[model samples]
Target: MFFRLNMKLFMFFLAWAFALLASSLASAATVEQIFKVQNRTIKRLCNERVIVTVNGLFPGPTINVHEGDTVIVHVFNEAPYNITIHWHGVFQLFSGWADGPEYVTQCPISSGNNYTYKFKVQNQEGTLWWHAHASVLRATVHGAFIIHPRSGQFPFPKPYKQIPIILGDWYNAGVEDMEKALAAGGRPELSSSFTINGLPGDIFSCSQKGQNSETFKMKVKQGKTYMLRMVNAVLELHLFVTLANHNFTVVAVDATYTDPYVTDVIVIAPGQTLDALFTANQPIGSYYMVASPYKSGGKMFDNITSRGIVVYDHQYAQYSSSHLVMPSLPSLNPMMPFLPPFNDTPTAHKFYSNITSLVGAPHWVPVPLEVDEHMFITVGLNLQRCDPATVTNDTCKGPMNHTLSPSMNNESFVLPKGRGYSMLEAFFENMSGVYTTDFPSKPPVMFDFTNPDIRFDLNLIFAPKSTKVKKLKFNSTVEIVFQNTAFIHTDNHAMHLHGFNFHVLAQGFGNFDPTSDEAKFNLVNPQIRNTIGVPVGGWAVIRFQANNPGVWFVHCHVEHHTHRGFNMAFEVENGPTLSTSLTPPPADLPKC
Candidate 1:
């Protein structure tokens, strides 16, 4: 009798499990679409929009999928330029084919072309995003992708509700216009403010006046908790985010759970995502959800550009006299996150250092030795001239290097030094700070930001320089240090690496001594990061395996600084381990 009862229970459990599996499969969402990124007239204003988006919207609709299910996204490009999509922070690790980034792993889809991205959803149940990866095309093409748990395992605290808060910056002048201006060596004007979900601050009023903004408003019940998945979609800005009248606890970042960090304000940089739990337990009221530039001493031009509003209840309108007071936040101080050592043992430390420093090793073989390299550069900021034109023109009229500028071979980076230059020649030959490939493997270099005893032009002012005929090889196992010279800007520079994440060895002020640094390097363990900040007037050492191919961008992560020409690219040639098994671009590849 007992055996019979056990058999019945086992059969029942199997049946229930099968039923659930069937239902989940049945509910799997499908997104079949062809989207175009183009300029269209919205309300008679020539607004740049992504038309023919999923179901015909500017931003393709949010894609909801369950983990362990297959996702098929068929994209067609009707736009003028080629575009590619990356499902950022998604756990499609083994499915590298569908993990997009044009020219990195696959080619972009050209205008009047189509491409299908298919992969299994093996990521943790969390908030994720999708954006275009073409030459900075994310400025217009992006949307949210929310993955639910197939097994009902929760990644965060279950709130009464949930919402995705995508943060993006808008340049109403149009992305193509910005790109054109930047390429032209002129300032690409920007919108006065950032937007929340593509909506500006005064949406209701703006709408009445036939205006459109990106700000999004949320209504909540008193005494309820809400899960906010805040995604930073801005290409370059690191934002300091906060909500008036309420504090939040950050539960996750980049889809990884963190020890709950409670704070009144949160700082999130580009390429970083945060999950915060907010409470609406206060008296029925309204408050502004605000985001501001995280850099310090930013010019005091005050305008409420980064904004959203949260209403506690319907009665908030009745309390017309009540003003939602903004909370006092800790002064923004950019500091490195405290982390555990990467290689604790001495042997492991030595091995790690070898991986970073050894040329021709599997780690470092990819970085190309220059066959015909142009200018190598060291970039930073400096003080400004009292005159506004000099300051803006980067003329440096005062005594010494006035503000942040790019330097080549210990000289400032300058552009178009030749006389009687033609437009075509300037486009290719007259770039500032041009250099040859003859840089030494380890030079005794010095950087003094506090005070300059020696004077140099802020920009290179000579003929274009190119690399020597010989190549300069670098070991992947070795560490590269960047020294920041003096600049008027008090803020530090963010170092971003391309192709691979690197271990940040250490950061300190003053010049770098190769022999001393090599001996003292912390190879045993270091913080692994994709972007790092080299403190003002200081130096930062980064270690990575040069494993990826093609040209990769390495630059100061500060958007504006980079816009001012403080960046460069590295070539990672295929290495021995790089297999001939590598695939070629698809037939629909776009030509830029």
Candidate 2:
């Protein structure tokens, strides 16, 4: 059914492309400039001034192309730092060679250097973005890459007007300093503010420096429907997005147009994108447009960050004129509260065990993954060995639970030599837990995700007695279950695989019972997704065909979890690349 659905969608898109081609052709444009960035704010006192940017913008430019047009993006890195452009979610189906992530696919374009990424836009009309695929710099490097419909038709309903809203979180700390801290054995402080585009504070709050902080603003007509393309580009945190007094129909998710789900509130995680249409139905009044954190772990942190607000007006003008109002979005759900800091009573232990058991029940399974390979990946938290003087910041004490440090196995991977432009690029390449450079060619050294532990103890460490390596043949039919070792913050981890989407086999907590869970597997109507949650202390099994050529990535989707080393890489040798158009990076690319 999924194969048929994909085929039908593909054909429809092709027809739509023909229509678009008949209606209009795209004009190519070159946008370039130098941007000035500074980390002078008191909050980010540790950051340094950076002249790194393309066309004078952190995200370079929005490359607007048609479904069949070719895009040439030249990035010149003038910054003191190394940089590279990664077109995220741009399924390089036949052109996986240019699918950026620095080391994983291609080498990074260095500072004072330039590289051009050229690719044919073959995807159906949808929302996608680009960012620095190297190191932690993605924090500062990212922007929307909008593809208009080809001459024909669109996959989703066309709105009167489209707005590109890139949601991100900004830290005053310098990107280098923050990454250094995280790399040098310490937890980086939680961001004090989240921004829309790049604005903060209540939309109307005056900045401490006497000027108003920029708020993510939008203009809308009261009657016409508007399409908001929202991308949660922030590395960490899931967002619960809601419009004040107005409801929206989610037209698409992760760029895949869905059967529009209507709701006033929508939750999406990092690396996920949503396209929603709002009719601007609120009365002629100002209301907050908010995105708050979807609390998984952590104490009830009341911290609220508002992107901006929607101002509804009775204006019937051609263009709705309005200003953005940033507010502190309040949380509708509080975190599970914390009890006494110190506790070891029998009741407390029993209560904790019961709570763990209750939460450890059947982790919902999405559906069957129809692929050629099944691989088990491990995800857990581990302590970082760091110099006490340099690594131990006041924000966290001894690692493991206090800080949500996650890892795949105990070994936090380091990228092998000669993959990307710089060490930073190499570091980010390992974000997917699986580091190709260092990973063994055979099956994993440890396959514990299939274990039957109901709950992994927070402080307990699980080490395999045997270091003997096990190897699984590439492309073999397999079933690999992932068990979360609740060592880190005991929160569910969304396991995502790059290069292909898979069917959800089965999932549950309390030592996944092979017979029981398998019996419950929905051979039909099971949700097939590229990413699925491996419950904390629970297990999830995923199966897929390793048919696609090139190295693939599998890791936790929680951005922070990824940082702590829940990643690994798989190589799929010699498979037929899909018959699709793909382009190469352009020459004369500008330097950041």
Candidate 3:
């Protein structure tokens, strides 16, 4: 009996030791940050204005972590309005409760409230971002989220230095006031200036020589390569960036590695990120880096240029005297790297199409050979009738006796209204009447999608509004043809999807022809991205597997278009077992 008891104790101890070893091997790294959202006075372009900021940072703080790390951010809202932070490209995996979209995954954290976002970064490693998911707060509430590889070396050699280049828009008036004006049906107000890292830069006339004068400058050592992690956080503009006398080797985009391609100019849409490397090999001097709007569809945009300086430490000292005498910087005098025309759709398409996924890289998933679901979605701006009861004034009236609206598949998406419940919560609770899963897989009415000569009929352009979602089975592969209709405008729509990155198989202008386009799909090495730009008056084919269970938002990243209802959601059913299922919501999820 004594020998038997000793054996049992020894076996238990051995099992416990193995368990500890296993836990240690499987443990993930962790990164925790506390963000305080509050209003702070900042001077930009010679004006002192109060702006909403995170932790008093104009561009917020950058969160850095490894690929297999768990990130927890506790956001304390002290601002006057509601707020939520979205980890733009991070797959929340089973933790859908922390995927922050205003009403999709969770409710906004109201003023004076706090919420904690906790999620594990699965296989993604690159430059993603975080921004306010509510109201116009993202204008100032934005930051970089960088993830490094877990263990292996990067596909490319390590850079000597790395920097985050955030391009944004600036408004002289408060963003809330601009929102109100837009709601009043006033002409869409253009931003007063474009900014680079929260500065108007030395190129703008408003830049002064005082405490208010601001310019983003990067000092570089000679003959060393630097990695620029670029994010276009502009509210409505598609930007083109150029570094005078320098070229970039594009290595990654949207947190996915791509085959390196060299280019002189980089075109980026809102909600997009690009990682490029450039060597400081030019004559050591201050070179201007310019960011300007790339406007399409003949629409007005902020044409002012935002500039940053790339100064070589050794050369700047030698050239300092020459620059002091010349008030105007030499870099902008001729605009060394000429920007493509504002309407250069071909250049934009070329850059986007040239990117191919890195072969055999970590986290690279091949395009699914079998497709379980096929969807055809039409995205464009339209006009719909407004209920008089909800219309307060003439501004509510739109052109041709209708109200301006945007739609996907002829359905203007409306957010479900209630408090303390998100779309996921309602789904889990089996609550009816919040949203419907009857969203059409194709446009309700078929017409010449890209006909430029078609007459504009108000009746044909009107779309019905509803809170609807597309339902998908667990682990089912989905193929969507995003067709951009030429309605009120013909512009490139930057479509962004939350929770999962899809494979962009092919894209082109005009309507999509299955016979011709299906043959064009690059199934072997298609580019994987969380956001893609549907070419102006064109179409794009994308595919993904709905392995993550939860409600995911698919929308045009243009702030105005999303505000006007060009959005939809995917409701993916939970898998049969707990491993593939969504975890329960955290106890601290904010109430509406």
Most lDDT-accurate candidate: 3
Candidate 2: segments with Cα more than 4 A from true spot: 1-52, 58-60, 208-213, 299-302, 317-371, 384-405, 409-411, 418-481, 494-496, 503-511, 518-547, 557-560, 576-592
The TM-score-based order of candidates, best leading, equals 3, 2, 1
Query: Candidate 1, residue 311: CA error in Å?
Result: 1.3
Q: List TM-scores for all candidates, in order.
A: 0.62, 0.70, 0.91
Per-residue error (Å), model 3, residue 106: 0.8
Cα error, candidate 2, residue 28 (Å): 12
Runs in model 3 deviating more than 4 A are 1-27, 208-212, 315-335, 387-397
Local accuracy of candidate 1 as per-residue lDDT tens digits, 437-492: 24333322533443444234344221122221112122234356776655443344
Q: Candidate 2: lDDT over CA atoms? A: 0.53
Local accuracy by lDDT, each model? 0.52, 0.53, 0.86
Which scores higher on lDDT, 1 or 3? 3
Model 3 scores a TM of 0.91
Ranking by lDDT: 3, 2, 1
User: What lDDT is obtained when candidate 1 is compared to the true structure?
Assistant: 0.52
Q: Roughly what TM-score does model 1 have, to 2 decimal places?
A: 0.62
- Which portions of model 1 show Cα errors greater than 4 Å? 1-33, 43-60, 66-71, 90-108, 118-125, 147-150, 203-215, 297-304, 314-446, 449-584
